[model samples]
Target: MLRIGRTPRQKPGGLKARTGIFGRLKKDRSGATALEFAILAMPFFVILFASVETFVAFTGEQVINAATDNIARQIRTGQITFNQGKSTDKTRTEFRAAVCQEIAVMISCSASEAETPSKLFIDVRTVSSYDNLPPTLPRTGGAGSDINTAGFDFAPGGPGTINMIRIYYRWTVITDLVRPYVTNLRPAGSSMPNDYLMVATSTFQTENY
Candidate 1:
């Protein structure tokens, strides 16, 4: 029969039953968990990686501090002397070897890099008095700031002298996401910022040998 004024609508369970399908889709919760995880995963992973890198960086500092103390003790007790040109006198290269040996577990330096190490910079010098010690980290600034190694030398004075040993290392940071907050160094020629400078200094008076 043909409808006269208004056509009759189909029933809920009838052939044209789109209302039920739409309602069921609206009530579905299948993807809710995945959606929540996707929103939180990025921040969670970032925090996790930052924590790990911080711990590693701290451990590296401790290793450096211990090495500095050990090397300074040798200087204090006359076990290692410098600049006298004696048979047992230690040169700059020998001093670096001792330092690398102390920190080998955390940092490695091969035989070839002993003369000019890429990662480590060491300074051993005699100070006239306790008030005359050099700055722990000396920087030369103009265009780009860098560690000033110009006055750095291995001239620890002989017996009954005050000496200081300072060590600097350019630690390569791998996690770039937290690098800006972790360090202020912007290594020259690098496309991205990545270095965290670590410094350790020790001062003591040499024993009468």
Candidate 2:
């Protein structure tokens, strides 16, 4: 009798072993790549934005400080008028111009260089003698209405005295990205309307005999 050819029997475990290897490979694939990217990107973006804002705020402060210091020096040296005869408005305009120029140089920002003329406000107060005792007195009032109402008096035969010069500037950020965060870094609105106030005071004793 011719016997039927018998096929070799396959091992039952072989198929299961192949399936297990493929399953593990699929599971090990780098998971949630998109989620990983999103998580990593947020902090970088926040840091970058914060750095930009901080730099802008710092630069603005430096520019304002330098401008105010220069104006104070001019007043102290008598280059700018503080007496009653000269037009206060005219002196104010000139002081503003000088400050703007100085700030432009300091910051090198086009916005700073081309600031709106209306944004600059200056007040000069002169007191020849405080309480009629000395030739001059220390100038005060950087944050109140007292400076606006007070007047400096010249001693008879005493030198001219300029009690104070206050410079106020309303600087608007050209880069709006960081404006809100830094707006409060400036002086309070009580001293300035739209922005911060930089007050530089210089007391001068008249050299005129």
lDDT of each: 0.83, 0.51
User: What is the overall TM-score of model 2 with all chains considered together?
Assistant: 0.52
Q: What is the per-residue lDDT of model 2 for residues 14-55, given as tens digits with 9 covering 90 to 100?
A: 888998999998897477797687888877766677587567
Q: Which ten residues in a row have the lowest lDDT in candidate 1?
A: 135-144
lDDT per residue for candidate 1 within 96-207, as digits (tens), equals 9888999999988777656986778898999899999764458876433567888878889999999999998878788878786666566566567677778899999998
**How does residue 78 of candidate 2 score in lDDT?**
48
Clashing pairs in 1: none
**Candidate 1: lDDT of 115?**
94
Give the clash count for each candidate: 0, 3
- Supply candidate 2's per-residue lDDT for 102: 77
RMSD of 1: 4.6
lDDT of residue 148 for candidate 2: 34
Whole-model alpha-carbon lDDT for candidate 2: 0.51
